[model samples]
Every structure is written in C-alpha cells, then in structure tokens.
Target chain A: MNTEIQEASDILKVIESANKLKGAEEPSGVLRGAQNAWDLLSDEQSQKHITTGSGDLNSILGGGIHCKEVTEIGGVPGVGKTQLGIQLAINVQIPVEYGGLGGKAVYIDTEGSFMVERVYQIAEGCISDIMEYFPYRHDKASSGREHLQPERFLADIYYFRVCSYTEQIAVINYLEKFLGEHKDVRIIIIDSVTFHFRQDFDDLALRTRVLSGLSLKLMKLSKTYNVALSLSWIWRYRCSNKLEVFVWLFFNDRLNTKDMQERRNIFVGDDRFCVLCNISASEDHDHLFWPCPFRRSCWSSIGIQLGSHSDLNTLISGVKDTASAGLFSEKLL
Target chain B: MRPPAPKPPLATSTYNQQEPRPEKPLLLLASSRAAKLSLGCPLLDRFLSGGLPAASVTEIAGESAAGKTQLCLQLALLAPLSPLSSSSLFLYSDLPFPLRRLRLLAPKSRPDLLDHVLVAAVHSPSDLLSLLSRAQHHLAHPSRSPNRLPIRLILLDSIASLFRSDFDASPADLKRRSGLFFKISAKLKELAYRHQCVVVVTNQVVDVVEGNTGNTVAWSSGRQVSPALGLAWANCVNTRLFLTREVDGNGGSVKRHMKVVFAPHLPERTCEFVIRRTGVFGVEPAQRSNNSSEVKAHGYYLESDRTRKGGSNQHKQCTHTSI
Candidate 1:
C-alpha cells in the first residue's frame, strides 16, 4: 500500500511537470494576442467567396451566402425563387470575370420543375454576346469551331429530380461520394423543399423535426466544401394573403378598391392556390423580382425595397446602381 | 550473436554530451499504380495524374442520362482489374438502375473485376453509413497490406436521389441532410487515408434563378438546390466534375454529347467522351473534326496516339470559344 501510494505520487509529479513545461513554453499575455491577430490577418484573404447566381442578389446577400450556412428564399409560385436557385448554380460554375464562381454546382430538384432545356437557353443568351463581342480571335483555320456546340454547354450542367424523402437521403450519400472525388464544387441549390416534406411526413412537428435535421446537414456541408447553399420554399397558406396584398400594391400605384377587387377576383375562393395572378407580371424576370406581389414582401422583409410596378431589368439596374452608390459612399466616408 | 548490454542509468543531473537529433519526417508512399486504377478513362487518367488520389473524394455531377452513371460504371469495372496491384475492391451504393444493367454495360469486363465489385442496394442513409463502417473495418485490418489486398475505389450513384427522397428540401431539412452527408464524407476520407482508396460520388442538379436576368425559364433557370447532402457531398470531395449534355451536329442529325464542365485543380474546360459498346472512350480526333464547324475549341484535345493507332491528329486549336 505504501509503495502504491508512492507510485501514484510519482505519476502525479510527472504529469504536473509535463503540464508545467507545456505552459511555460508559451508566454501567455500580449504575445498570445499578437499571435492570434497575425493569424487572423494572414488568413483573411483566403476566406470563401460565394456567388449567388444573380449579381444583384449577390450584392443583397453580401457576396452570396457564407460557406456552410443556410439561406432560404421563400415565395409563392412564379415568384422567381427556383429561378434564382438555378441561376446561382450556373453562375457559380462560371468564371469570375463573367460575375460567376467558376466552381461546380449541385442541384436537387424536388418539385419536378428543373428543366435542362431552359438552362441551355439561358446559357446561350449569356455567352452569345461575350463570344461575339470579344475581339481576340485567331485565324479561322487555327481556331477550332466545334467546341462551341450547344450540346457542350448543356453537358456542363448537372441535374437530379427527387420525388420522395428516401431518395433525398440516397442523393446525399451520392453527393458525399462525389465531393470525395471532386473538390471544386462551390454552390448547391434545392428547389422548393416543402414538396418532399409535405408529401412524405404529414405531421407538422415531425416535418419540422425532419427539416431541422436537413438544415444542420446542409450547414455542415457548406462549411466542409466551402460552398454556398440556397434552398427554395413554397410559402404556406397563412402567408399567402399577405403575399397577395403585397404583390397587388407593387403592381398598382394605388392599392385602392379596384386593385383589391382585382386581387379578390384573382384569389377567388381557393384557399390553397398557387395561381398566376398578373398577366404582365408573369411575362419576364423583372416583374418576378420587384413587382410580383407574392414575392415582393419577402424581399422587403429582408430589407430589399422595391419600387412599384418595376420591371425586372429596371429593378436589377436600380439595385446595381444603388449598391454601387452605397459602396462608393462608404469609400468616400 | 547478441551484443553486450550497457550499464544501467546513474542518478546524476548531468546531461548527455551527444547532440539531439531532429525527428524523422513522416514519409507517405503515394503509389502511382494505385492512382491509375481509379480513372478508367485513358484521357482522364493522364489528365488527373494517372488517377484520382486515394484518401480523397471526387464528385461527378450531371443531369439525367448525362453519362454520370455510365462513368461510375466504367470506374467500377476498371478499378479492380487495374495493373496497379491485385485484389482491389470497388463498392457501389444506392444505384438508380438495376445491378444487372451494370453487368450488361460492361459485358467485356473481366470476370475477376465483377467478383471483387460489391454492390449494395441501400434504402436509407443510415444503412449506407453502416455499410461504409463495415467496409472500413474490412479494409483497415493490418493483415490487409499493399501487396495482399487493396480496396482502391468506392462509388455512390445519384446522391441527390437518396437525400431528396428522404428529406424535405426545406431550409431546415437541407441543413440537416448536408450535415449528415458531411459526416459520412468525413468518415470516407478517413477510411481512404487509412486504407489507401479513392472514393467517388455522383450528384444531380437543380433549377434555380439565373444571375443576370433573374429569370426561371429553362435558359435562365440556374440550378436546383442540392439537399444538405448536395452541399456536404461537395464539401468533402477533393475534385468535382460537372457533366452536361449537348446536341452533336452529325450533319443535322443530333447526337447526345457528354462533356466535363468543372474539376478542381484541373483545367477549366470541357472534354467530350461517348459511352459506346466497348465502354466510355474518348472521341477520336477524326470524329472531332466532323463536329468542328459548330464552335471554336477552348480545351486542349486529349488525343492519345498509343490508344488509337492509325488515327489522324489534325484538329484546329482555339481557346476563346465559350460553349
């Protein structure tokens, strides 16, 4: 017993001495603080830069969502939420000069709304001007023409459709394998998360529980991959009226009795309807972002104010100018 | 023939006169042979330094029928019988098509390759995790050394399907799903490092808003939000390849064209390949000329004279084309 006690004391002494040596190796006051500051300054430039498919959107989002954080875009149908998600994927994959990421994008479609043909159309529009205007062209003989085939553009985009929750998990595992093999992916989009959950789990509590789990997973993934993640959602019925009113006010200068009457007619008696209300609003991208009543409120709620009845092109231009002005003002100040 | 023993330590406070030696640096023996086993495509094999590095994950993402699965199938069939060493293993989980289709696709693949390839029809993420853990155990046994048995490649087909099917795409659900995917990928990376294997996964794309126009049309529609799995999968991968389809103008007769869109630490350009009867092979330079009238070439042609004998190498070189 005496020997055992002595042995225990000896072990304790060794441990204490080892710890003391470790502590003594570092001078712990101002030097430690200086070390931390140096580390922070050195690593600041290497921080991840996320590109939210849209230039205006990226500006609003402060250079896209931070890597490994969740950013939700919720609105009624035809409000450009899904469109924003898809654009981000393509833009994220594009080179930086084109106001894109030049990184890979992963997309999971839950609402059966992901259309590959549309992506090609957008790609054609985006790249055509660049190809035509760029003056640096070698001789036709030296320059190979076959590489610009539309099929080539289509091949750069990846697509997936999910109809159930189980398939969602499978897709996740597949994504894990993909990231393991290829590490340049920087953006991920999920079109309308509510459909899968709404279809599979009926109970709200269980649904939220499942959603929380998914949210945490995405957050971790973004951090691990250093990628920006965006999720689309369909607003529930409780928020539909407010959305409708908001849209009505944006389209009509005055939200008087006639506009309310038109809104009433548009909404009708259908309590859970995802209808296309304004004919003009449904036509282009500008109307979808700033004037589309159903989504206008969402943008405002997030502090992105929009002018009444503004078209998408004008709204984007306005947003850009405003953002630049803000930046310029900050620089001046 | 034992050496003479030294005297015991004395209770003295004096230090030794000999100088302290610096610790030997840890030397990792990265095998070129192992890398060659993972990349089945000859052009890709050469482009990616023989093959993908072991202990890292690679992502192959694309739309449906964009040849993502076909690529996976090619790797599965080629990994085990690769010239690197004997007794390599390939694992395929959560495949969309039937296992029979994989067999049919690679009919000419070696019988031994099929024998070593393990296909698991996983229904849930938990099941996949459990199987992966078991695989790690099998690969990590000390008895399984380099010359004995080497598990070189692992492939997971259609990652989006697995997560999208099980979790709602709600922000909350996506976060959770991505977290789980990140965890699994972390485990796979650890396993790869410990066992010297390459892990590959395939992902699907989504439609979102475009950046310039804020439009949701097919052309303006961006990409789908990958469930948390999508993001997590991207995070853990060491390289990423985005695949997309295009119309091959075979003199007005449209053919499906598959090209690589993105890869990390790789050239940011596209390369064309076709999944033919023999398997995924690079299109010959002669065939490429036929399609040359459409657009200027941006990426370097991955033409191998060794693979295609008596093939013409004349092709126009342009690096400005955006397609």
Candidate 2:
C-alpha cells in the first residue's frame, strides 16, 4: 500500500478509538434524554413512603402512601373518609422516633369539616402517646432533650380552606411553589377533593377538563417532589332519620311509611324528623352531636362514662386537655 | 483443539442484504392489564381485583338501605387509591347528608375526606341528563384528552331514582326520559374508557313475588328482589353488582352481601361484608400478603367453589402455618 494511504488509515483508527472512549463515558447519548438505572436506584427520592398506622391499610397500599405519588380516598357520606384523611394528617406529625413520618401536614379543607378544636385534640392525643411510650426509644428529639413543643404540630400544619372551585384550582396549581417555600412540609391533604367540582360548576364538561388538568398537575407534582398528595372525598347520600334508626335498632328489613309512600307514587320530603335519631326531637348539630339522651348514651360507651355527678355541659364542652377529651376529640374527628 | 479453519469469503449478497441493527421495539410503557383504583376494602377490592377498573361503568343496585349508598361512599373515599387523581363527582337526587349516621358507621376513616367531594342534586330526570352531559363536557378536551386517568370517579347516587319518580309523567314522556337515560349511560361509558375514570351508578331494586306460599307451603320464602332497570340499562354496564341486606329477623341488616351479578371480566360470586364505624369490611379483615401477586395467583376471590378446592386448601394451610 502507498505510505500516504497507510498514514491516513492510522489516523482514522485513532479517531475511532477516541470516539469509542467518549461513548463509554456517557453511553449511547442516552444521558441527554434518560438516566442510568444505577443512578435511578440510588436516587433516594423515589422510594419515600408515608405510613398510615393501620397495618392492614398499609398492606393493601403496596407500601403505605408513596411520598412521590398521589393517594386518593373515595367514599360515601358518613363513611369516615375524612376521618382517615385527618388521621393521616395527624399521623404524619408524629415524631420519627415513634414510628411516624415525622413531618408537618398541609390540609386543604373545602367542605367546612376541618375543626381546629378537633386538631388540637388530635395533637394532644399524639403528644401524650409520644410522651408515654416514646421515652425509651433512641429519639432524643422527644426525650425532653430537644425542645419540641407538642403544640408546634398545629403551627406546622398549613391549612387552606378554598371555598370555591376556582380557589381550589388556584391553590393546587401553585402548590409546587408553596412546597418549595416550605421544605419541611411532607404531605398535602385535600379533604373531600371533589366538593367544588360538583357544587360550583354547572358546566361539567368544563369541569372534567379542569379536573383532568388538576389531576395531571398532581401527578407531575408527585413525580417531581418528595411529598404525598392525599385527597379524600365524601359521597353524601340523602337518607331519612327514620330508616337510619330502624337499620340501627332492628336487624330486619321492613318498608316504612316513607318507602311505601315512595313506592306507591312519589318521594315527598319529610322535614319534621330528627336528623340524628328517630326519637322525636328537634334536629340540630349540638343535639345530634352531644346532648341528646341517645348521643349521651353513645358517648358513655367511648370511656368517660359521664357520671351522675358530671355536668353534661362540662363533659361535652368543657372537656379539653384531659385524656378523655383527647379520646373524645380524636374519635369525634 | 485444532488450528482454526480458513474463513470463507463473504458472499456479495451478505452485506448487500441490508441488515439493520435490531433495536428494542419502541417500548409502549403501560399497565399490562387495565389500570384500576382500589376500593380500600379488601374483600371488595379483591372481589374486583384491586378495585374498580378504569374506563368502565359499574352499576351498584340494591333495595333501599341495602348500603348501596354506603358502598358508593367507600369508593368515593377510596378514589385516593389512585395517587394522581383527586376528583370525585357525587350527584345526589334528593337525599340529605347523613353526617351524623356516617360518623357512627364510618368512625375510623378520616373525617376530612368528605370535604373534597363535589355534590349536586337533580330533582328530575332531565336535570340528571343535563348534569351528565355537563360533566362530560367538563372533562372534554380539544386534542386527545390526557392519557393519565383523571376525574377519579363520577357517581350518580341513584341513577334510576328520578326515573322511578316518572310514574306520574305522561307515558310518552316517560319513554323519552328512559331513552335519554340510556344516552347518559353510553356517554358515561365512553368517558370512562377514554379518560380511565371510574363511573359508578347506584340503582334501586323492586320486589318480585315468588311462587305463592299457600297453606300447604307456609314455610317457604315469599319474595325475591331484582334490580329495577330493565335490559336496556343492563347492557350498558361493564359490571353489575347486587347488594342485599342480611336481616336478623329484628328488621336490621347485620351484614350485607355484595354479589357480582355479572361483569365483563369477573364471574358471579358474592362476598359477605358488614358496615362499621371504619366503613364496609368483610366478615374477616383481609390479611394482606406482601407478595400481593402470589395471593392473586392463588385467587383474588373467595368463591363458593373454593370450599371444595384442592390447591387453595394448601394455601389455607400455608396461611395457618404462617400465622
């Protein structure tokens, strides 16, 4: 072969070897659009999970709530979907030494169900539980070594009560920025996530588009941030007090005047019935929630068996700070 | 063992055959089976294999107070089982919010989930029909709607309640209303399939008299109840579940039976459940196995036939030993 040709071929070989070395450094240029599986495995952010205390629940969830995912809780009215939402919100606040996620909660309340009094009660219960059993654990944070006030949980929780659908959309849209501002926030909870979609919007087609956008945004947020987005929605159904009481009291199925009336012709509204029980009393929240003879009997079953010497007002209203109050409020929420 | 044989010269066609390097077929990453939302109730979740399948219509029917509404609420709460979506639309016709009763029945679940539900009521069938179209439009998009499932659930508390109230309306109008009803169901099915949202509709049941219990046969059961909506509505559902109360002779349901009457994917079977302050659960709380697929492989269902099963018996034995 000619000397010139040989020299040119040698240069080509050297350039090819250099290119192969460069390829090994990055591998297929995939680094531009993708990542190395080894790096992904070690990324750490994708593996975080926030646990709900109920083992049964965690088991069904694959691994509790994935910190980098959205978890939705769906249920009908009176099914305590919100109660679980609140439970997780409060459970997330537990100190890491006590088997909690040990982070603050962001609660978005749309249905007017968030009770601050109820939150105080939950915090009190969680704190007492921590103080009682968490001492022996390695958590110096809660061993009176670290000055962490129990009430600090309440302060750490960021709550947004968006009364309208627009407000809800606005808050969710900018939640990423908010989370960036608050690095300590671990969970974002929207109590009854679907309230405004049903109530405010007459344009459901538009609602679906908007909802789909929000869902996509939430999905993206979960992927990008190390936070769990938990949504809880209540399925409220219209039921009369008479049927409810009968189902509670008797174990048989019998058609009532209302059922028969509806079966024969039309379902007319009956307002005189007590909202809580069919025991023939005026329907109201205070009566239904606490003071009624039936409600009092139910409360006694919980623990603080309101003794004859105990005042109902004190037991119902003045009950706070005590263990019984914590129990009551915890159960109430 | 020996010197390598002289290599044969490549045929002219060997390099000319246009051999392109094989590449991994553009991977279409997606769920092997359809994506589903968990119901959060193990018995029910297992019965449906992790919850309601997306892009399908699930009809829940039962007699009044048969806990049809309760199951709906459970699904509404369980929609969070889908990590990405948080929207649930609960359309009520005329029922009041039984908050007090719910507090008792659903005591353990978080109280805040109720706040996220979007609730609307329709007084008439037309109102319901319009509401459904509006919902459809709300989720519609100009381009291909998002591939990710959105609007976790769209519920019609009693999709047939207003239709049942059409008894006093003109026969011709009732016919038109019933026709419109089918349209809503069709539109709902399309939305479900397209958006992967769960569309659940609660239906009522009517009583049917059995062969008469004459004096000669006084001990026999007298009546049987069946879902009310006729064949037209039946064709629209991907899953039809029948719920009934298990009365204890004192006029109360000690338990409820959620029977899969029919489904495109599931066979007929019934699971017994009871409503508690913690919501609806099976007679036995479902003990979750870490290898969920192993449990599913054994069976995601508790079939009546399994009482006679052979392989399943060994699984039962394994469970006992594990405990």
Candidate 3:
C-alpha cells in the first residue's frame, strides 16, 4: 500500500509540473485577447471584403474574400486558381471610395507559377471596373488616380517566392511580424500550400504534423491579424458528392446480385462479365452506370444522358445541367 | 597567504570615485538603462527592442552561412561604442576565426576597433568550461584597477562544435551533457549578473528527425532544422533566436531571416536582412519607405472618409456555403 501510494503521488507531481510548463510555454493562446460572441459578430460585420473580380464568385462567397477568415479556393490545373489568387491580391488594393477593402496583400508563391503579366491584366480589369462603376465621382477618381495605377497595384502586393517546404514554413512563421509592421496588409494568399508537402517527403507522420501546424498557424493569424487568408491547394476526396454515395450504396448491398458480380470479380479475376447485360465486357462502376446496353435504356427511359465520363466533376455537372432545371423550377414553384 | 580584510565602505567609495560606484542602488538603477549592447545596426536594434539585454544568455542558432557569425562580429565591434563602454570577448571553435571578414566589417574610422574585442580559440567544451569558470572570478572582482574597460560582452561562436562528437546519443551520455550544459549556463549567468555583462553564444542546427512536435518553428533547407543540444541546453538560455536563409531563384539574392524563438521581454518577431560589405542591413520595403509621405496622405484621406461614412454602414447578403 505504501509503495503504491508513493508511485501515485509521484505521478501526480509529474502531471502537475507538466500542466504548469504547458501553461507557461504555450505562446499561441496568449497573443489574442478574449472576446465575446457579440464582439465577434460586430467585428465580422464591420470587416471589409476583397472583391474576387468576378461578380458571381463574389456573390457566392458572401461579399468576396472575407477578412478575419481563411477561404480555400481549390480547383484542378487550368481552372484559374492562380488567376483568382492574383485577382484578389490586386483587387485588395482597390480604393476605399469604391466598395472594396483598400488594403495591401502578401502573396506567398510556392510553385513559382505567379505571372506578373497576369497580375497586371487583373489590375487593369479592376481599375476599369472601378471607373465604370463610379464615372460620376470624378473628384474622388482624380484624387485616387495614382493609387489606381496597375504599377501601384503590382507594387503593393508583397511577393515572397519560396522554393521548398522549409522556406514556405519560414515565410509563414515570419508573416506575423511582417503583418504587424505592415498594417496596411489585409490579405495573405498562399498560391499553393501543398506543392512542397506533397512531394519529396518520406516521413508521412512528420509531413502531417508540419502541415497541420502550418494550417493552424495560418488560421490563428487570419483571426488575430484580421487578415483574409486564401490557400489554393488540391484536395483528394475518397467520396465527395451524392453520386459517389450512390455508387457506394450500390456496391454495399449484398442482396443485389448485380453488384455481387463486380465484387466477385475481385476474387475470380478471369470472369469479367457484366452482370446486367451478361456480356463478356470488363465490369466497373462507369460501365455498369452508363455504357452497358441493359442500363443505357434504363437511363434514357429516365431521360438522363451522361456526357463526358472522364472525371467525376464533369459527370456531376452534366447531370446537374440536364436534371436540375426541372428540380430547381419545382422547388421554386 | 591570509585573505585580505574587507575594506571599509567609505574608503572604497573614495577609491572608486574615478569610475561610477556600481554597488549603490541609485547607480545600479542608472546603469540599468544602459544595460543593452547594441548590434551597430539601427534596424536590428529596433527589431531586438534595443539590442541584447545584459545579464542574460542569448543563443543565436542557425544553419551554416545564415549570417550568425556576421551578426556576432558586428555586435563585438560595436560593444565598446555602447553606453556602457565595455569590451567584448569572442571565443571561437570548429573553424578558424574569420579575421579577414571581421576586418571587412570593421569601419575605416575605427582602426583600433579589433583591439577592444578579445579573441580566443576554445578546443573543447571542457576548455570553455574552465575558461568561463576562471573568468567568473575576474568578472566578480577585477584585478586590474583602471583605464581598461570591463569585458561586458562575452560571445562563443558555434557552441555546437565543442560537443558534437564528445557525447553519444545514449541516455547516460545525454544526462551527462545536460548536467554540463546546466553547469556552463549557471556559471555564465552568474558572471553576467554579478558583472552586469551580456552572454551571447552561437549554436549550430541539426536536421529535425522525428517526434519533435513542439510549438517552436525551427526550420531551414527544405527540412526542419532544430538547434543542437536539444531540450537540455534549451532550458539554460534566457533568449533564443533562429536565423534562416533563402536563395531567391532568379535574382539569386540571399535573404536572411532572424526571429526570436523565445525571450523574456521580446515577442516572437522576425525580420529579413542582407549582409553587405559594410555590415548586415535590413531589407526595408523600398517603395513604402520612399513614398512614405504620399502613403500617409492617402491613409489620412481614407481614415477621414471612413469616419465620415461610419454611420451609414451596410452589409451585402450573399449565399453562404458551409465548408
């Protein structure tokens, strides 16, 4: 009993000391002061937004890029992820006379994909939009003419070209002080946060820790500094939408003999027969859904045609275009 | 061989009147204002909140060619010029001391600047231990009476070299190393506090391998590089600063970053600077500094405009998508 009690007391002492050290050394929590829900709501309301240069995207994003929040804009290659980042960086410098947040930007480029010519074009586009909107406010426009220049816009966006993951982390860790000194900066856009982390990293656990720490630091920065953070990165989802769920459910049913054939193919590699058509075609999700003769009629009978089964996103968009007209109208009615 | 009798306080006061008596509380308070040793750069001084504080162990940890030695050289060069008017002692290990580079950083006006900085080559951690322990006696009570300034700035460039191969990665060896670290730091701190001197040590960085899930962001060269000696020596230092370098691909200009990892007084802050022939200079945003008046005017206008339209605030409603 005495030995057990001594061990327990020693453990308790260790736990107490650990807690004390944690409380003393945890620097993340001490930077920002406490705020109630009302303060947050008020701060949120009064926050200025950076226009995305596209009215639709701006409208969809609840008044463009939000300050004090991290908005991830992700898409495949050639979908203009870099373009939107550049657009936001340029549009952030839009004059306060217009309905925009007249603040600077810090652009962290990991992939060396940032084009200055594209940024100049976007700046020109923003200036034209501002001129078109407030043509009558001649005095204000004249006074802010220098600020509206593409050169000035390009100059305001502080660009840090980081080569590797360590440089990326260093730049991000350095941003708190950078933002503190440059108070005019209201947005931080990391063009690609995952480019360096995705490749050349052998230890999976260390990569996850570093990436999570980077992301948490970013989130805290956006909140503490009240700066908008836009991170563009590729996300791989195992299951994304209802279509994927339907596919999952179709395979999940053990009672369904049709899916059983596809499942049985896993064990019996030679028997590659389509369950629905009884044809000697290799069975897969795409073949069973659209291309197979037995299911093609059924899909046409339901008045749905699949276009471009190259990718899931295109497939979803195709379905949305054909089926969503009636569904949206019915909901509206 | 008897110990000298303790001198009477009144007699010592008259004897030490040539220099300010350091024992008085009033004089100590006056000296506290001049406690920091400036690094010779206004921008760095500002970034460090009036340079390195006296009576503290400051560790400047960095990878190779991160300008750690350059910074220490500048600090040593400028130590005698500070308000305290004290000299610096630089103990180097591993590589030979860069005397040529030191001379390049030395200004043309101060021809005898090197004389103020005392340099010594320490072969091992044991050598450093004995040196510092011996210096503690000299620091507490200086034998030399007058004319010469006290050594208030003590710098050991690359403390990692001394113990890199001395200890193996075993529990027992690590425990011994940790004890030595504590002993060295305790003596250094004692010397600093008793003599009101500054202690600065440069530490090399090693690649972070695994299980380092700490809040500290010590990174370099596409991998996380942590300060050598691990957590044992980390506890000994009063302040820790990390220096990182990046080579801009196209321009090829090397940008060096210095950040405070942890400090009693300073917040975690970083600044970018470049090393030039003269000294290390901070890379200020050129346009911002040049067009300061215009930017200020623009900001003033915006502020007034904001206050004028403060009463009529509006919010645009948009579709909210749950992430």
Candidate 4:
C-alpha cells in the first residue's frame, strides 16, 4: 500500500487501541469519571425530552431533535418546512408513548407566518379515524351525555414573532430563562432564519460570522435546555441568460489539478472569485437542493451528492418513510 | 418463680354482627375488553393497525377528485357510531361541501354525529391553525365523563389548499400560511396522544418536474416541470397513502384505487374500491366457472346461431349478469 494508506491504517490502529483502553478501565473508575464529566458539563441538571411529532420523522431524527443542536431545514418556498416545525412544537407538548414529549414548544416566527387555523386542521386530521370507529355516545343511550373535546390539546403550544436577528436572539434567551423556570419546554422552532440575517449582512465574511454566532447560540440553548432547536432557511435563486465560455474554462482548469486541494486554500485573493451576473428566478423547494445551479455547485464543494429528487419535500418524505419503517439509520448528511 | 398462669378464658360470641358481603357482578367484564371499534374495512383497518391507533396522526394524500373528501365524510359518519362505546368527534376545516350536502350524504347517521362534527370554514391558513388549537382544547376536556371515549378522530380535508398562494399574498403572508400549518400539525399530534384519537389529513398533489427532457416546444415544453412541496410535508407524516384512478373494464365509471405508497410498516401496493350512495365499498368479484372467460372473449355466440335474434332488454340484462 502507499504511504497515505499506511498512515491512515496506523491512525486507525491507534484509535482502536484507545477504544480498547477506554473499555478496559475499572468499572468504578469509569463511573467516577463519567460523574465528574457530567458535573463539569452542567450548572444545573439538564432534562432530555422528545417532541411528539409523527413517529416516522421522530424515529429518523433519533427520537426527535437532540438538545443543544440547531437542526437547520433549508428549502425553497412552499416546501412545508415551517409547517413541519410548528407541528413539532405542538407534538412536543404531548405525553410520551403517544409519540409526544408532553412538554411545551416555543415557536419563534421570524416572517410573521404563524397562524391558529391550521392547528385546528392538524387536530382534525389526527382524530378523523377515531371518530369513525366510535360515534358520539349520547345518541345510542337513554342517558343524555357527551364526551370528547379539543381544548385540552391546544393548551400545549406557545407562539412568538421575531422581526430581526436581535429579536430572534432575545427570544432564545427568553426561552432559556423560561425553560429554567419551567422545565417543560422541549422544542424550539424558528421559522425562516435567513430573512433577518440575509438582509443585514452583505459581505460573505460578515454573513458567515453572523450565522456562526446565531448557530452557536442555538446550539447552546439546545444543550443547556436539552430541547431540540429547529430552524427554517429560505432559498435564494440567481438566473443567468448568457453563457460564458470562461466559466467552463475556469472549471476545467480546476479539474485538471493533480492534487485536490481544499476549497479555502485555492482562493489567492478577493478578486480571484468567479463572477456571473443576471439570473432569472423561480421559487420552490426542488430549486434549493438540485435544480438551482448555484446551490448545486455550493453543495458539491462540500461533498454532498445531490439526488435527482433532492427537493425539501422529497427529502422529508423519504426520511419520514424510512423512519416510520424503522429503517432510518443514516445520519443527517 | 413462677409463671403463673391462669389466663382467663375468652368468651366466644355465637352471633356474627357484620353482614355478609355480596359477590361482585361480572356483568361489565366483557364490555371492558370491547372498547376498541373496527372501521369494518379490513385492509384499511390493517393499514391503521386494527383500527386507527388512538392518539396518532394518519395522513392521506391524493390528486383532485380523488375521494379524499368523500372518505372524510364517510369516516365522520361512521366513527362516532362505532360498536365500541368510545365517544368520537370530527373536526373539519376549509371543506368545500355544504352542511346540507353532508347531511344528505349521511342520512342514516345519528343526529349526535352531526353535533360532534365541528365544522369551520377557514378562509386563510392562519385561521385553520386557530381551528386546530380550538379543537384540541375541546377534545381534552369535554363536558362528559373523562374516562369515556374522548374525541377520537380529526379530519382535515385537503390540507394543501390552505397553503396555496391564491389565498394569501406577499412573502410574509406565505410564511404565515406555512407556519400556521406547521403549528397545527404539531398540535394535532399532541391531541392524538392525550385523547388516543387518530388524526387524518387529506392532501392535494401539485405538478412536479419529472426529468431533464431537453424538449423545447414553446408554451408547453421549454419549462414543463412543475413544483411540489416535496420532502418537507412527507417527512412530517407517519403514513402516506396515494389514491389514484384505475381502469375498470366492467364499466367506464371511475373507481378509487388506493396505494400504500409510503408507510412505516405497510407494504406498498394498490387496492380497489368503488364509491356508492352509502360510502366506499370494497368490490369482490363472484366466483366464475372456467368457461366464463371463453364466453366473455367470444362475446357469447349470437342468439340467431342457436335459437333467436334480437333478445329483449330484460334477457340482455340477465345474460350480462350471467357473464
């Protein structure tokens, strides 16, 4: 084998040895070490909770979102990302075993899309079957009586709106405080994280910095509260009518290189970046994943294989199907 | 020294003052185990695990005129009057049908079924969300016995219509539309858990791009691909059944063909059903003789060849039945 393979093999051996050592430690010592680590990681005890969403989706996400991690869902317009997030929040408030966390959800709507009517629709959809099997009991009996009501289930969801990035941060902070006081909030949904940050930060560096901060904050909240933090991302499109021969030439030059270097290392100066102008537009989730040439290029840089059906809706459906079937073993790529 | 021992003899009373406890009756024993009711459609019930598992979401999607609303109406009428003693409720939002039509469709339905069905005409996505929350609130603490059958079913006919842009305007408005739907789905899941009711949502299908055809016919071919919500909505649902039209050689009329396109535990296959005046009926063909196919293929020898020509309408109908 070549030196690279040899070196990789050596590293693997070292990792295996380390794992063996970790496994061989005295049980008491390992327990003590685990306790110490847990103590150091928290100022207060963290409560782990799950959101009561669809069983398939929850199972695929490893039993709902993990606390202290920002699950970013990016899709073109009308892919149902926001709707899924809202449903997650509501589901979190339900008791476990019924596919819910039995805790409250904090919904932060950055784009002012939260609505109450759809909640009823969801409830209606959920109970349509039960009603079919057992009709209202009052009609068959001599005793005048009634059963079943909807108010108890609606009490679990809490909604909020954030107009700016700062406001979004404030909401997270407030959620942390609220969680501390009442350890029942298990899910946090922020609809459309792109709207606030995209408008204010034009420079790439500045945008990355802002996004990094926001992601860090969301991560911290997730871990600290043991709540799943789900955020939605809006997709942007660029349409180009004119074809430039230089674009293909530049790409070919990069492809001809012997060594595949990191993308960051290739940028020698700010002016070296490729430029393409004037693009048309259409809005849909498929555009965000595969159809959009710009996004496809970006994703390719990160080593993600874009599938033909890479739209947000298709992905969600695929995941849900797998999750429900108890076959969703792959991690989020 | 002494343990003296003269213990006084206890006096034995012959009369028992306490009355004998009566044996507990076993009259209600069988009724307790019969709590769960069946939907009567075995295949559909199997998809729902014997019946819709109480307190869960079951989503149903199909193209336009795909019987989604019709099934919802049928379930609404059938659910509340189940053989099981559990109580039920049906909540509908943004349905196109009038109350009178629903009443006519379910003439045999119990009057209480009508009352249990909470119908709301939602004009916007936001309003639909509010209706879900309200229904949940009512289901949790009905004015009846808490231990009795609680609100059992929630039916959302064509959830996609609520997200259509024609109902709203502006990016802000679209966001609100989708956000509201998200929240509603979440709440319904919760309600399903608390009440052990099943949640069913009907969805509409939009055209989506199929593949790179490279065809360039103006007005129809340049950009022939359509758009759909795609993965996002699919991910949220636990089960998804796609209903479509299937050809029936017996008659030219349309028949409902349901396929378990995406489900956690169910096999992916299609089943056929017909819509009747009462409700959806699963059609099973009668047993046929081996020669029936040959007779059908030949369209039966002409009557003139055997006995007579120009058979009467009644005779034709009888022959058709025989075939």
Clashing pairs in 3: none
Candidate 1 TM-score, C-alpha based: 0.40
TM-score (all chains, Cα) for each model: 0.40, 0.37, 0.42, 0.39
| Candidate 1 local lDDT, residue B236 | 45
- lDDT of each candidate versus the true structure: 0.50, 0.56, 0.66, 0.48
Candidate 2 residue lDDT tens string, B130-220: 7766766666642244533346588887877777776546765655655555556545655664455778898887665565221011111
lDDT of 1 by residue, A1-333 (tens): 999999999999998787666665554443322346665555544555565534576677776665555788885334446556655655555455434455666777654344443344444444553355443531342242344434444455555554344345335435554565568777667775654443323244434534655666666776574332211111111222223223223332323222333443643232222233444332233443445576666666655565554354365446546666444222212
> Which candidate has the top score in lDDT?
3
Of the two candidates 2 and 3, the one with more favorable lDDT, higher being better, is 3
Q: Higher-lDDT candidate among 2 and 4?
A: 2
Error of 2 at B225 (Å): 0.8
TM-score rank, highest first?
A: 3, 1, 4, 2
Return whichever of 1 and 3 wins on lDDT: 3
Stretches of candidate 4 exceeding 4 Å from the true structure? A1-333, B1-37, B83-89, B93-101, B104-112, B145-149, B165-176, B209-229, B247-251, B284-323
- Recovered share of real interface contacts in candidate 3: 0.00
